[model samples]
Target chain A: MGEPLLRVENVVKRFGGFQALGGVSLEVQPGERFGLIGPNGSGKTTLINCISGTLRNDEGRIFFRGQDITALPAHRRTWRGIARTFQIPRPFGTMTVLENLRVTLEYAARERARAGDPAVEAMEILAGVGLDPKAGAISGLLTQIEMRKLELARAMAAKPALLISDEAMAGLSSSEVDELLEILLRLNAAGTTVIMIEHIMRAVMRFSERIAVLDAGEKIAEGPPDKVVSDRAVERAYLGE
Target chain B: MQARWLLALAGVLIVGAFVVTRTVDNRYVYFAAYGILQYVLLATAWNILGGYTGYVNFGTGAFFALGAYTSVFLIQAVQAPLVVLIVAGGLVSGLLGFGIGYLTLRLRGVFFSIATLALAVVLETMMVNWEYVGGAKGISIIRPSAGPLFTNYVQLLFVVMAALAMGAVAVAWFIEHSRIGRGFATIRDNEEAAECMGVPTLRLKLLATTVSGCLMGIAGAPFPYYITFVEPVSAFNLSYAVNSLAMPMVGGTTSWVGPIIGAVLLGTLQQLATVTISSELNLLIVGVVLVAFVVLAPEGILGLLRRGTRRTRA
Candidate 1:
């Protein structure tokens, strides 16, 4: 196969003396829908933080499209096409929904020299996710699902090749979950690779083309969803052995 | 381009101040206008960092005093022109601001604020012990004779301050509407998110500090000539810090207009109170009004008005 889009090698993270991620390795291919699953505190978010440059790994090299990205700051990583949504949606509260996306669009345009109106581009991103009607509404006034969509749209505004969505569907109803899933799938179809960190098994099962299960800060299993779901190690990791 | 209106507004306001200077003969009016315009400059300058970046800087007094002292040293040494003093003051304070931001800006929230507070205290102490620039005993400059254009020095000073106030406001307004302002808004909203959105958060923050400090210093440069006396005690007064923060909070911190509204409203009220009551009571009145506004309208008068208009529309 061609070179993978992202490669995480022996990534370890620690808080105080506690090892949150001992040594986890994984690879995601270009244009693939990847799911990172774990029990609570299984180092899923830590790995995401490491990959997205929010937290640097103590011992690891993160490669993006054959380029080492371990030392880059978060914004530099973003400029090079790494974008993520916080597990907790953080819409710019004081800004209107359109303005919220425009912030990212304007930055990306400056970095990459895109020639178009950022406001129009911002509206397009909002419309793509069914948030166009509330373009002028203050972001803080958005409902939970709307905020999640906004989080994704803001990431999209960066025109990132790799998009990470951390717990984007938490606290969402089943229909809302499906709606968000559809949005992600549509984005993937449009040629953006996505890594979805989620607790919702149904959405993860339906969406992922490949799955990596992290347990106790280690990669316990990696395979197709069916095989990984049925594996004894994965089973014991979810429920006590 | 959209900010051209602000320039026009500045022109009108400056002309109006000149008219008042030409028509009104009373020295007190010029004095009062001077006070209002000074706060206008201070509040506008302070808001660039405090309001925009979500970084609260308590060292405004230090920056202001540095500007005033920059003028003092220049006069004692080379006898610089007022314009030269203003430019030098801005550059000097801006450098100090940038240096401080580089060293201490890594500390977030209240810790960063404490660092600035400590900086102000340390600078004040250095000024007290320093032998040059009058040390403990203040220095006074006999007033320069009235300029050919203006009838008196006070009138010229009033016009200068009015022009500075308008210029500061215009600069603040431009930044608020520009892409840099959006980046600042992101930093204020959620810094981590801003970073992930490709905003060079640290650079934007440093720019805010530099510009904010520079404008404040420029405002301070003319202050020595205004008072005709330069003293560490008065130049480093706590009121600069208090009034700068209060004016923005009372007006609204989000937009450029908020600080101007705050400076004018609170500024006018204080001037009135100082004349009718005691000048000491002026600070007390400011204290009381600030508290009332904080408790009643935490977002300031502009925020209150926006909400009121939104409600009426709804």
Candidate 2:
């Protein structure tokens, strides 16, 4: 009912001749668990990149809590409380895992984190993502799941009102997926809005209150998880009926 | 280390330099030490941008020469004091660094290195044609009288250089331990990720260039007085470019201590080679030592020492 936490209004992105994102639009509410799913090359990543200010959309405007941020640079967008995990983990290789979170805490969350010492706050974030024991480990040498957890923890260090998880569960074991899902669930319950772009159907169906499906850069279906799964177009888009 | 401890260490070093000036009567010793100390300042300046931020600037000589030239101009026009010359030189080169960074930082990797190389060539050409600060033929400077503090002008220069080198190192140490240093590390490791994490990579890179350039320029501000001649060719010597970069690589790129070690070791070696062999062999020494370090310890002497200590502890 109130202004959506994030609104994407008909974004178009073209890489030379090919349109990576073709006029896609979506909205996510405050404290909502939203899922965005598409087959490979359905423009899910492109759309998110546009929303996160990594790739500027050609035609659309983006709003975060009623502020137009479509023209902002990626770092400025981050300063405005939008944090994202890379689809492929991009841990700061030379720094310790704890230092990685410190980067975000010192920069993105500096204004909000006025009371706590950055090291103490960084350790608290690492603990929340279950990476406290590896706090001193070099981030580049972390195991895949640990890197993913570090990525999430680093994102959480921003204290973002909106957290974008992009294929964070990819290449992760099921138990790892469950663990990450639990973290996401807990984060959402504690008043953070989450946009999960995942390929894992079971995780999506279980976690999302509502889901939006993208097919070839278009939103094919969006509704409550059960209704969206049973929709004929959603089935066709996944199974090629 | 805490800033206070670092300041105290600097105080000790300055006192030691003053003692050497008092005790040693040999002028050549001051000459040789001044050369070595200049390298310490230059290499430390280079590492602030090159090592900390992963931006390789091949235009080290350009900034150094600019500072020297700034002094040359001021000396001819206003007969400014050494302090004023140093400040003016730093401001000029700092502005140039910010301008160049704005234009060229958009190009990453080898392209950025090439652009910096081009910058040295461009600056050299300008200096060669500029008549006010002496053209390609060069100009001689009459040495200023040494004040009550020292025995002669060269001794005064030696002490001044030692102070400058210590100040440069103290500044580098401060940056290495601060939030700016952490931001720089992220930019080095992964820039895009750094930006997404809100590190403000572009602004930080500009800050790096300005600070690095200002220090290099400050090191150069005394050169007109030190050498008593200002010329394009010698002022933009190829050895300065090579030594500033090589010293950091040989010492270690990660911390401020590495450049000082590299500069002192390599510089002393080169000074010895110049005395024992020929001055022409200075580059050859740098070449041989750099190759050895790159192959045996690519992380520099500090990295090797760190590995050594870790192994011993284990």
Candidate 3:
């Protein structure tokens, strides 16, 4: 295969004496749907945080599209087309929903040299996420599902090549989970690579082409979804057997 | 309104101040108007960082006093022109602001607030010990002779301040409508989210601090000339911090117009109160109005007006 879209090499993160991620490594291919799953406190979020530049790894080298980005700050990393959604929704509360997307389109995506009106572009992204009707509503007043949709739409506004959805379906109803899954699927079909960090087996299993399972700061299993799920170590990690 | 209209409004206001100076000879009018307009500048400056960027700076006195002292030093040493002093003062204070932001911006919320408050105290102590600027005893400055455009030095100073205040308002308005302003709003709302979304929160924050501090320093440049008594006590007065914050809080923190409204409304009231009641009641007026607004109109007058208009339209 061509160069991986994202290659993380032996990332280690520590919060004082507690090792949050101990030398975890992974690769995400271009336009591929990748899943990261683990039990709670299994370093899933920690690994992504290091990848996204939110938490700098104590020891690691991160390469994006062939350039070493380990020393780049979060905003620089974002400008390079890596975008992420928060586990909890974090909308710019004082702004309208459209304005939230405008922030990304104007800053993150501006590097792409898009030549159209940002407001129109923002509306298109909102429509894609099924949030166009609430464009003028204050984001702080959005319903939970709407807020989640806004989060995804805001991330998508960057026109990112690699999009990381971090627990985007947590606290969502089953139907809502399916709705978000459909959006992620649509995005992937349009040629955007996706890394979905999810606790919902049904959604991740259906969505991810391949899966990597992390447990206690280690990647215990990685392969096609069925093979990784059926692995004995993966079962032990989840079931505590 | 668009930026050009705001510029037009600012031009009209400066001309109006000039007309007021030309027609009315009451020195008291200039005095009262200068006090009000100074707050207009201070509140607007404070709102740039405290309101738009969501960073509270109790160090308003530090920046202001630093600007005043900058002028005081230049005046004693080289007798620089007022314009030069204003520029130098802005540069010095802006750099200090950028430094403080670099050091303390990583500490969010109340911790940041405390750092700024500590900054004011530390600077105040520095000024007190620096004997060249009269140390704790303060120094007095003799005003430059009036320029050809005005009758007395105070009148010219008043007009200069009026122009500066209007310039400050114009800059604030421009920032509010631009993309930079939107970046500021995101930083205000959520810094981490802003960074992840490519807002460059640190750079935008530094910009806010530099511009905010620069305007405040300009506001203080004319202060030593106006008061003619350059003392650490008065230059570093607690009123500078309180009024700057209170005016923005009472007017509204979201837009440029809020600080002007708050400064005008609260400032005029203080002038009237000092005459009718007592000078001691000046801070009390700010205290009462600030509490009332915090409880009844926390968004300030602009937010209240927006909500009212929206309700009527709906």
Give the C-alpha miss distance for residue A25 in model 1, angstroms.
1.8
**Cα lDDT for residue B186, candidate 3:** 95
- Model 1 has an lDDT value of 0.90
What does candidate 1's lDDT look like per residue over A110-145, in tens digits? 677555999998999999999999999999999999
Q: Provide interface RMSD per model, one decimal.
A: 1.0, 0.8, 0.6
Candidate 2 vs candidate 3: the DockQ winner is 3
**Cα error, candidate 3, residue B227 (Å):** 0.4
Q: List the residue pairs that clash in candidate 3.
A: none
lDDT (Cα, tens digit) per residue for candidate 2, span B1-314: 47888799889988899888899999999999999999999999999999999988888999999999999999999899999999999999888888877854578877888887888899999989989889889888888899988899889899889999999998899899899998999999998888888888889999999999999999999999999999999999978889999999999999999999999999999999999999999999999999999999999999999999999999
After superposing all C-alphas onto the true structure, candidate 1 shows an RMSD in angstroms of 1.4
Could you give the candidate ranking by lDDT, starting with the highest?
3, 2, 1
Q: List the candidate 1 regions with Cα displacement exceeding 4 Å.
A: A113-115, B103-105
Q: What TM-score does chain B get in every candidate?
A: 0.97, 0.98, 0.98
**What clash pairs does model 2 have?**
none
Best of the two (1, 3) by DockQ: 3
Task: Please give each candidate's TM-score.
Answer: 0.97, 0.97, 0.99
